[model samples]
Target: MIEQVTVTPIAPPPAVPRASTWAAELRATFTLAWPLVIAQLAQNALTTTDVIMTGWLGPEFLAAGTLASTFLMPFLVGGMGIVGAVAPLVAQARGARDIKAVRRVVRQGMWASIVIAALLVPILWQIKPIFAALGQNPDTTLMAEQYIQIGVWMLFPALAIIALRSLLSAFDSTRIILLITIGGVLFNALVNYALIFGNFGFPRLELRGSAVATVLTNLLMFGLMLTYVLRHRRFKRFNIMIRFWKPDWPRFREIFRIGTPIGLTVLSEVGLFTAAALLMGLLGTDEIAAHAVALQCASMAFMVPLGLGTAATVRVGVAYGRKDAEGVRKAGWTAFALGTGFMTLTCILFLTAGPLIVSWFLDPRSPANANALGLAATFLVVAGFFQIVDGAQVVAAHALRGLSDTKVPMIMAIIGYWFIGLPIAYVLGLVLDWRGVGIWLGLAAGLGIVAVVLVARFAMRKRLGLMAGLG
Candidate 1:
């Protein structure tokens, strides 16, 4: 009895000050998102700078670079989507405080990148002949080939960097990605000036120079990101170099299972735009130029919500991992609201300042200026409606991805874009002769359908306890 009286109870650990649920989510999302937004803006600015500097050389240079970029975009964009599979997986692991799983996911993602790059290089190498066969002008074909040859070589390093960056983003270390990206863009700008113009004793490579600059910048970014990851204390013990090289079968299967649908979903949507551009090219150079300008403007606007969508992925992933159904619901709705509000503001700007915006990309006195401005303005008006829907769809898609329900979204995209959007665009633009505007209407329909479907999917997943394993 005297010995038993000696026992004493220990106090429990103090509870974390509960962050205001909505406010916490917003803060976390923005903390992760703003850096990405800045990085995207910087990247866009660098591209704009390249175009501006190249514009001095004449329209042929601009056209050549545009064609090259367009040809290469599906791979780059689709690869980015494929690599995106790492983020939600790692984010969930982080929420569960399972650093080992996060490390495994990163390693698997690198392996996926290698596989994707291997497949991409040969296909991209052969695309020049395809473009030529498609009836591009000889001069445009030659320039595009030259540029794409160099650009394709960058895919390996770019994919690697993307994989690493996705892992870091899942850990909420977005600032590192931002810093590296901005630095890379700055370096690219300098290199572009030196290479494109034959400055500082460099050879006058012109468009070829642009490709080289882009490749060099990508290499630099990859090197820096790798170095940073290796030195990071949390990651230093993982031995990712060996692990990634070894290829864990289980992790690879999981990534491929989740990643393929995402890849196809992105490919379908991006392919739609690429197809539209190609069809527009058939109309004439002026139409192509106008479409390019309008697309560039729309892409820039799309990035804002894309950043928000990425943030939503992390938010939803963490919430799901914590087994907080309410938190997941709130995260999705909050992301939607934020994305819609930002897009609405952009819509107003596009409506009121469409001409001014178009002028930034084209010289008002040029031969194609009128066509570019008029079509760009029309595209912007249509984009105003679609951008909001686009934002909603992307955010909803990410929310579902956090729940690991990628297949449904992928199927929806296939139906919405291929079965619905492409047919409508072809009929309205080619058969009915509505041209560029008709193509845009088709895009709007597909995106609107996707938006509705994705939201519905997320709701269903929530009701079904998709995050059951998260707890």
Candidate 2:
């Protein structure tokens, strides 16, 4: 027996687990975020072009355009937010490798988009009286009404783009989305230039030209995106449009269930800004025009975070679907980091170069533009102060959205924006006679409040049971 003793072979060492690093997470987040950022910037450039051209027409046209946007954006953003649910839904489906679910959700999203646009378009048609009811300037209201009447046609296509873009984003085909949007920007500029100034043998349409250009650009974008989605090998396999007229009531309702709160969440924040525009209107035309210029600058910078936020929604949604809590955490915090970092750069630019940036919107040398330009520069400085909070809040809200958490954030938005932010704006701007600067400070306060609450909520997700079901 002693001579027959056998030697035991050495056991293989246990496999070492690969840990995720901040560098890897950052690279992954940036890869997903960059295309979206470019797409968002290009999309915003469409509006910026309209703003630049309208500003060239004079302060009145600029004021009218701002008023029109104030009315239109709430409707558009709310509807788009509803449809935006498609993104996280599709993202989760992909994570689970449920291709059929992806098709069903996207189809229903299209149906939802159509229905939302149809209902909202009519309401948007009544902008004149609505503005009047809100006590906006009569002249500006009339002009805005004209612009909206023509621009309303863009809604159907616009909402459609959101649904389609949601699909593309889920598939990580956002490069095409960026290209298509860039094309829309170029086309919008050319059409606006030709029709606005009556160049290239086209009759001048002025504000109406901008409206027509907007409609055409949206249609072109929708067409191009639809074509790509239908033909692209990566996406065509899903056959998203196979049963075009079929009803999927549950998915459609699910879109609204998850989305209505999202829409209202958007309405809450955008509505706050719109109300601020109305407040500026009360101050005077120059105030409103200046607000428009400064707001556009802020909005342009905002697109970066907005795009990053969207990417976070998809990334975190995928991770959540896979029940990978660590992945979700990495994806989410990475987005917050990138978004806030970019916003820091923008904050410095706005603070240091406020006057120069304002001049790009209005001719600094012109006596007519002097007052508006000065006000715009001042507003930009104020906008700079809120940049970090603004970026953080939007990204945090989107991170929650990835977890399919909408209702609470919606409530938070209402409390922060409407309940807290608006009252401060009214008191400081009106009651205290702080006027324009006061209004901006109030906006900053609201954004800061929401940011704190949202960031806190996200940070405490696991401890608060938000990640209970997730691994």
Candidate number with greatest lDDT:
2
Regions more than 4 Å wrong, model 1: 1-20, 468-471
- Per-residue error at 231 for model 2, in Å? 0.4
Clashes of each: 0, 0
| lDDT values for all models | 0.77, 0.89
Q: Give the TM-score of candidate 2.
A: 0.95
Clashing pairs in 2: none
Scored by TM-score, the top model is 2
**What lDDT score goes with residue 395 in model 1?**
82
Candidate 2, 211-283: lDDT as tens digits? 9999999999999999998998777877888978999887888889888989999899999999999999999
lDDT of 1 by residue, 277-368 (tens): 77776776666666777777777777777777777788777676556667777777788788878888887887888888878777888774
TM-score, each model?
0.92, 0.95
| Per-residue lDDT value at 180 in model 1 | 89
- Estimate candidate 2's alpha-carbon lDDT, on a 0 to 1 scale: 0.89
